[model samples]
Target chain A: MSETVIKFGILGCAEIARKVGRAIGLAPNATIVAVGSRSAEKAAKYAADNGFPPATRAYGSYDAVLDDPEVDAVYVPLPTSLHAKWAVLAAQKKKHLLLEKPVAVNAAEFDKIVEACVANGVQFMDGTMWMHHPRTAKMKEFVSDERAFGKITAMHTCFTFAADPDFLENDIRVKPDLDGLGALGDAGWYCIRSILWANDYELPKTVTALRGPVLNKAGVILSCGASLYWEEGKVATFHCSFVSHLTMDITAVGTKGTLHVHDFVIPFQESEASFSVASESGFDELVTGWVPKPAEHLVNTSLPQEVLMVKEFSSLVGAIKAKGSQPEMKWPIISKKTQLVIDAVKLSIERGFEPVEVVG
Target chain B: MSETVIKFGILGCAEIARKVGRAIGLAPNATIVAVGSRSAEKAAKYAADNGFPPATRAYGSYDAVLDDPEVDAVYVPLPTSLHAKWAVLAAQKKKHLLLEKPVAVNAAEFDKIVEACVANGVQFMDGTMWMHHPRTAKMKEFVSDERAFGKITAMHTCFTFAADPDFLENDIRVKPDLDGLGALGDAGWYCIRSILWANDYELPKTVTALRGPVLNKAGVILSCGASLYWEEGKVATFHCSFVSHLTMDITAVGTKGTLHVHDFVIPFQESEASFSVASESGFDELVTGWVPKPAEHLVNTSLPQEVLMVKEFSSLVGAIKAKGSQPEMKWPIISKKTQLVIDAVKLSIERGFEPVEVVG
Candidate 1:
């Protein structure tokens, strides 16, 4: 019956951890209880630099943070290669897990993490922040409206960022021993998530990587794309790269309407985001111009999407910890589906751009 | 030399011809001198309903319009099946040709039309009106700016319209013996043209149709998509459909910039059009949102794009008529390249979604 505040432990000093740390500070039900790094001095510096509260603990290793009794949840911002190891450990420690994506290098590894969470009765969620944005719900409303959006026919999503020379050469994402999956695991994670999100979380029947994928000498993808086909004629394609300009776009066309968002992965503004939609649009009598032009809809939120994500995860964790409620299954299910598609795309690429059946 | 007005004779009273007739009237140096249909009554009715000038002649047959001495140029709005026959005949009659696109059923037929125009020393331009939009030139300026846009990387275009039940069953676009190519020739033409336009009219090395193209029982494409690959790592994908909501979008990304236009085929407004451009876009600290957000650039025009197309065509025709200037080859060249890609996509679809080498 008492008010519960979820205590979150930071499980690495990765760059993304700084953002998640800020998000923890912003979430009303969440508090940063601990910070950890391989070196105690680095952990202390990260806590100080990210503005951890005075009472927050700094640990010399991820094991120390997971071993903290007061840490109700752990946000794992470690690289993709470390996700399975740390995520399973945190779940075994009975801490609700907020893991970063690509949740693992492949769905098989991710299933182990999911199993650990289920066995421990701990909540699990991936760090796909945009899924928590208010604008996403609003856009989903439009796409689900039968009279407005009708049945979706096709969708295309692209997420690309031009990495600086230093990042391209030395970033963890490009290193096989670190992130391992490279751009496909990083940027393509978001792209596949988006395609699945647009299709109401329905997994496609097959995924075929497009030809001309650029891979580094270490067998890490630098740029790639894939087309996913579903039964009933629904199709989706996505492109993700670390070598193109920063561009995030989603164009979903349905029988009656279309939804277009230019900045989908990261919004143009922190407080508000906009998407354009047109329903039953047609040209004028002379076909010179559209009769009913598409209209832009804006959704505003007081907190950044990352903060909203932390708040949502913490709330789920709080329910399970304080009231013995069952952990939410939707988040992990979505994460597993996203990983499945990513793995299918990688397999398609490895097989010379052939179609790979997506088995659930 | 006296100023010469290029007099246009419309071959066939197709619905699209009404729009072109209006554009011909709007172009300052162009006049609708004749309109012809299979029946003289239909021709007269089309001219009257479409607001042709009182002095415009109505002919019972297309040959009569071509035979008129005052008709310096002809706008061929006939079906695809008849384009080669009518376009070549108009060229042989010493008339400059403004041909409707899918310029022919395939490149072979289109090339024959081109040869006839060359032999007759006639100006040739396809009725791809968007190419003449003032906004298009503005967009080109952004994409071509080395400092602002950087080198092109990838592009995606979509043009779709949900046909009403009546149109789905009876429209000329879906008829096998009429337009034949259906949505690909109609909507896909714009998508291919936009991709080619973004790439500075450079033809791709190969074209591969995406899987699951929806075809009508009549063997006409109802929906389709294709990916084009250039040897220089530039890639493009486009989708066109008659079973989806009306949406025309182009997203072109470069090394340092991105360009997006939602209504590319037909601007939402006749007087002004806008596109969004993001040059050297990046994220702010903490990576919460975009810094230097994409800017919207608007271009205004007194004439609609179609009228501008007519005016540009007439200017070329007038130059040849009044000053004995040679016909410009750029327009025909671009049209041929677009047709070549379309042919390749069709072939790829026929070959069960294999990559088709695009031989220019």
Candidate 2:
């Protein structure tokens, strides 16, 4: 068998794509041989600077990138509003997909994309790098198997950052159609994804939301709160805000114990993350003078998103080549479940918190 | 004219009445002149045993106790379901009233009671004991006036306790018609009351609630969660449970710092409370550090609720004895607002959190 590398083409010169493109370029068995943009000159320039040969493709249109026979996979970093259209077009070309977070603006649109991918027999994976991380799998195993946190009673997740306009022009985050789901889609999805994955992808039985309007900006949500009925008796609440302080924290409370992660999504680059679990009896006895255990460095070393993402993608490509097919693993399952949850949250927001049922 | 102690009468031998009876017996310048119950023997026995002479009167029915000219005031500790009827009757007799907490089941009922009190030209007060405590007034002044906590943004209050069926048997708290408001009417009212009082009587612009049933217990709310919305994007979430492990705590987050009080509502009784404020740049620091404030110890000091009750009631009596035709400067304005907020919370619960427009 020939040791074949996955040839990759990326559409949209999005901020995220720049990092993902670099990742693909560095992947051991992957090559970003093509780049597309709205401007032909810009596309050609990007391809040239990024080591694409003159014979390699440089297209001014999105469809032109998908039309290239040498491109086995397409990385779609387009705005959320454009995610479904591009993913469908790429699937029509029978190319594997790595769509950006949220996958689509809403669940219905995401479903159509999923249907198209399945119909074309193409591999579809939503770009949720965190879920693909080894640490995430460890978290899931601890919560679900080890039962380190007992029967989950409540989970609180927060993701927030100050949005400075000048740096984010035409950013989908401020687009009503693309980002109307607001912080929930932008950052809250991670919390939702984390909770769902930890709970074996048990969809919320009921959901309610509270939304605040963005000030000093049009078509942006300032903050949002969501409550999820995860099971017959367990409930979870999540909050995200663009106008508040920066934070990414997830805490889970259960029958006999509690677990907390201070920074789950974007952990401090130099600071290791500390996790602590205390049982009911342990919590009581240790209250007087409880010394928290030293933090464990989950990542071998700090790396930029582009480097880490490329590392993971290269690993996946290698595994697929070795297996002669997709690795029978959790990534596909995690991505599908995460996108479905993202869609449900958008629906709940639109209906002013009317419960939305999630189905497979 | 000789200064004379005001005589007080109480109808019903409910546990609340027993508490009030002791208060009346020990309150300075007040007398537990008479007692009444459904049974004449029980009424006579209670009156005699509690130091009320036969000359002070004992009656089989509530009206008999009301008609005793020696009883200058009446304490109505009847079930909230029975509050309206007995309060109206007490008002008709021109007797000043000490109505138990949750003055009425709903706003309309509370309005009716207020109207009846006005028509009879008698003083009426809700027995929400917490608000009358000096510490409550001090705390409110610190939070809102001094801004001790600084721009309070969020408040989390939890009140949970195991119910004693022996004490609650046939109690209005367990009676559907009387305590139908559930936790919003019972202990939950205190949570809302505290927030409203602390926030200068600002009514919640929006609210969300989750209620769980108390198994096999009639008219009792086993657990409830309510999130309150305030102007300028502030929020307060409160939880009350009858089935959870006993816990009570209130935490307030503000721009300048945070304040936490454990066992809040009855901190004066069951626990000690401390407040800590962090100094932040560009904000005036008013309160800082964990200062151990004195806890109100009336409940266990054997000083009797009557002593404090009479002290407060005597102020109204003194105002009455003055040249003014009606008692003035007796009832704290905060009490009126607290009642209104309690009514709004009930309306929110019944109407499924529809925004209740509150009159200033």
Candidate 3:
């Protein structure tokens, strides 16, 4: 407990947990103290396979990790259906929470997790790694510049990956009782989060689900899109799917400038990410081509974005434990807004693709 | 009539006409034989300013230009409201029509223009300049490669330009009786056309207007967006506006590949255009970044796309005039499909953003 490093315990040996486990090790202020799975052998294998330190404990059950007084925080990479249950339990046990996205199946469930965090004075943040990328910050600076970008008019984001047939049928994401929201929860989360980030986290006024959403036999969304409208005429649209090639893009157009990025969910390179921006773009005198073409900006990062996400989350936890500071409210608030939009989109789709008012 | 070159008489001295006039001059098989405006002095000025040949005729009335028996074709850059009238008249005069888009305010009107072209045995093509770009052909080769791209799943296109106050207040595009459809016709035309082009000219089954379209005082849409859905589950969305920074993009995602172009309407340079494509994109072993990032392909062209459009149109006209061949039906068919989608989107907006079935 006297160690300066934030000791982390991950609940469930999900595939994503391995990545986060590495992130915990890479993050300067964090360390993996333990990992838990339903089977002790799976936990041991996951730790051994993912380069967890020899000192890391392999727990037979998630509760064993929660009960470990040495574990300062828990990374919850369990299925969406298990998020509220385990995240709240971890929070009650005084473990700071790093919950995987689609933080919960719905906003109400996320609210329960948030309430637990508040009651137990635990720091909470979702596993939206891209937000911590240095390139994201640089892009935000350009878009927020009044002289350069002016008022935002519209934004569009998309994230899609062609999932293998076996994955589509057997993955927990498609199971109604597991990651019930399917691609909308897994892939759409990034698209929606990017839009909200471009809008400076302002909630949209309404959400309308685009037609022709592909659904699995279990009635889970395989692919879908939605348009979001703000009261001030700023509009955004996003599409996400498990049936298309890997493509992640964010196109935000303001009155004076436009921002374009092809890889927003993950960088094309671990050390660097790039985006293009054009300010006051116009055609040449002859109307043949662009007068001032967009210029690409590359941001270099020493640590991968996921590791940065872990560092940021652990730093907040450190502040709470060391200085008795109140838990950071920003991450949970943003997570709740994203969950709200996701729920609104789902409702709009359920209502025969009608426009659903987004209630903040 | 004995000359091999296609003689083009341009209708009106609009700004776009000057560009097309230069395009006509650039096309090896097309010559600007005449230009007509409401004022003879304006026609003379336009012809002189645009470097038309000394022998080029200047007419005070459009009818005078159409009456010239030597004029084999006419490039109609008049406002949308005048398209059906002038285009049909040009066709009836046995002049091949290179009409500015949105060819007409509606498909029914464009049908009249096409019917006249059919009756008069003259070629018909809308002035969608980018369609003839060599880069477009190259991009098509990649998108159509089944091994590389697989089945088309979704596409999104956007075209927007920040309009000055004068333009918003007084431009012909904002006048209901002039362009009528406003930004939807002026800018959205290219977006819808790009979507149709990506789908290989297959008409969408339905069109749903996205919420939050901005319209001028006269009820002309200044900014708008719509989502088009095909019966086979392919979906496309597009946004066009006169109030955003200049941005023309096409992001087409297939089951196995993705294509991205930033300046699709107009290239960044007159001599070359580039697009990015990724086939079977995957993540690196650690899932940190793309394993093989999208590669950029550049295509060089001696003539700008507008000039290519003129060349293609005149080539069709030349074949008909010299070899006694039938006019190409492909141009009109594609133009009609584009107009049909536009009309459906307009209808959807009028119906309170309901999904309107597109009947081609």
Candidate 4:
């Protein structure tokens, strides 16, 4: 009858971990039990600075947290290069895994991690925070209405942020040894996920990288884009970059309706998010203006999106721990699809922007 | 000295002619003097129904309007296939021409019209009404500021409308002999023009049509999209369809700022239009939301965009007529560039989505 609180272990203190750590503290069914880094002292300092519980332990390495019997879940915000290794080990150790976006460098590597999680019978989910936002649910509801929004015809998304000179030159994202996939993995992941989610998770028939992708001196992608085509005439295109002003946009057009969200990745306000929708819109007699103007719909959330994400992940972990339920396959399936598309885009770019068939 | 009103002759009784005739009436420097159609009765009915001035004349043939000495300028709102024939004739007859969009079936046909205008020293412009909106001037000013917007990184635009079953079956746009280019020339023209405008009128190096374009049984494009790449790494994309809800969007992202306009073709309100701008935007400490959120920029226009287009065209004619000045080359240059890109897209689609080098 007591509350089912899933104890989580914090990964290395990457910048994103600060936000996720705070989210863990805020999630009703989640608690941070330990912090891990290469140096035990650094882990202690990170836990103290990020307001982790006073009793939370500090570990000298990621393996220590995975070995701890008390840590039921591990939130892995480690560099993407380390994901395939650490994620598989975390699952083998019987710990629920909440991996970050771009779940792995590619889907081939992530398949091993998936196998480990299936073998251990532990819940697995990615850290795509926006998917848990209430606004996203509202948008999905509007798009699902058969009469209001008919079959989607096209969707376009872009997520870009201008990185400072120092970050552009020295950040892990731009360094070949660390998160080498760069902006495509960091920003384009959100764009691809949103596109697939809106398309009801239907993988594209072919992925073609757009021409003129920008890359750093070390061959790390700084800016890139790709177009996806489905068999039934649906098309989607996305652009991501570390060389543009912060802009996140998603425009979904259907036979009878259209949906637009300007701040899809991060809302302009934490408590409330809005999207514009126009159903069966047309022009006036003289075609001077729209007859029914698009209207904005606002959805308010009591908790921030990241906290909701943590809460959602923790609930699944709780079900496995307390009720002996099977691991949910939805999150892992979505994560794999996103990674597959990413891999296809990378291949298309590698093959001179040719179309690459997306493998199931 | 009293008033340099450019006496305008409308070349057809098409649905669009009604709007342009009304615009001619509203423009202070323009006046509808005559309307011409295959049937004189239909032309008269169109003129009366559209509120043309009482003294306006109706003619039994398009040639009659071009032959009238009082008609200093002619507004040709005929089908795209008929444009090359009538527009060049109007120019050869010494009438300044305001031709409808997709000025001709392709760039080759439009080039002949341009030649005719040049030979006769006649001012020429296309009927892309939104280009004359005051809001466009404001958008240009914002993107022109290098410090605020930096180098433009990417531009994406779409213009789509759902056609009724009747229109899908019988509309001139869906007919191969009338408007063979279909949605690409109708809706996609605006998208391509908008991209070129935002990119400071520089044409892309190559144009590649996206895969899976929808075509009608008669081989007219019903829905299509293309990606354009510049040599300097600037990329642009556009989609146009007659099978989707009415949606017009333009997202222009630069290194330092982003600009978004949902209703770029037609404003929601005739009197006011607005766009969102975010300059140097970033996230807060927790990355929960934007720090300096995108701001909406409202632009007011006392006159409708169509009326402004008519007035601007009239002013150019008046200058040429009153001072014996040579025709302003800007409008014709823009029209040619737009038509060239349209030709490239059609070629790319025909060549199995191959990248076609854009010809100047």
How does model 1 fare in lDDT?
0.91
Ranking of models by lDDT: 4, 3, 1, 2
Question: How many clashing residue pairs, candidate 1?
Answer: 0
TM-score of each: 0.99, 0.61, 0.99, 0.99
For A315-355, candidate 1 gives per-residue lDDT tens digits of 88888877899999999999999999999999988998788
lDDT of every model, 2 decimals: 0.91, 0.61, 0.92, 0.93
lDDT of 1 by residue, B1-360 (tens): 445778999998888998999999988889998998999899999899999999889999999999999899999989899999999999999999999998999999999999999999999999999999999999999999989889988889999999998988999899999999999999999999999998999889889888878888899999999888896457888889999999999999999999999999899989999999999989999998888899999899999999999999999998898789999999999999999999999999999888899888
Docking class for model 3 is high
| Chain B TM-score for the candidates in order | 0.98, 0.81, 0.98, 0.99
TM-score of chain B of 1: 0.98
**TM-score (chain A only) for the predictions, listed in order:** 0.99, 0.84, 0.98, 0.99
* Candidate 2 chain B worst ten-residue window by lDDT: B281-290
Candidate number with the higher lDDT (2 or 4): 4
Off by over 4 Å in 1: none
The candidate, 2 or 3, that scores higher on lDDT is 3
The sequence of per-residue lDDT tens digits that candidate 3 reaches over residues A58-154 is 9999999999999999999899999999999999999999999999999999999999999999999999999999999999999999999998999
- For candidate 1, the docking band is medium
lDDT of 2 by residue, B1-360 (tens): 644577788877766566566566666667777777898889887766665645756779999988988777888877788888888888888888888777777666766777777787777776665555454555555566333356665555655444445535655675677666555566777777777765667776766664222323563554566667776657666666443323344555454434444435544231223333332312111111112221222223334233465657755765664544674423534445656666665555567644455664
Interface DockQ of each model: 0.78, 0.05, 0.82, 0.84
Residue-wise lDDT of candidate 2 within A76-170, one digit each (tens)? Answer: 88888888888989988877777887777766787777777767756666666555445555555556633444566555565654445552455
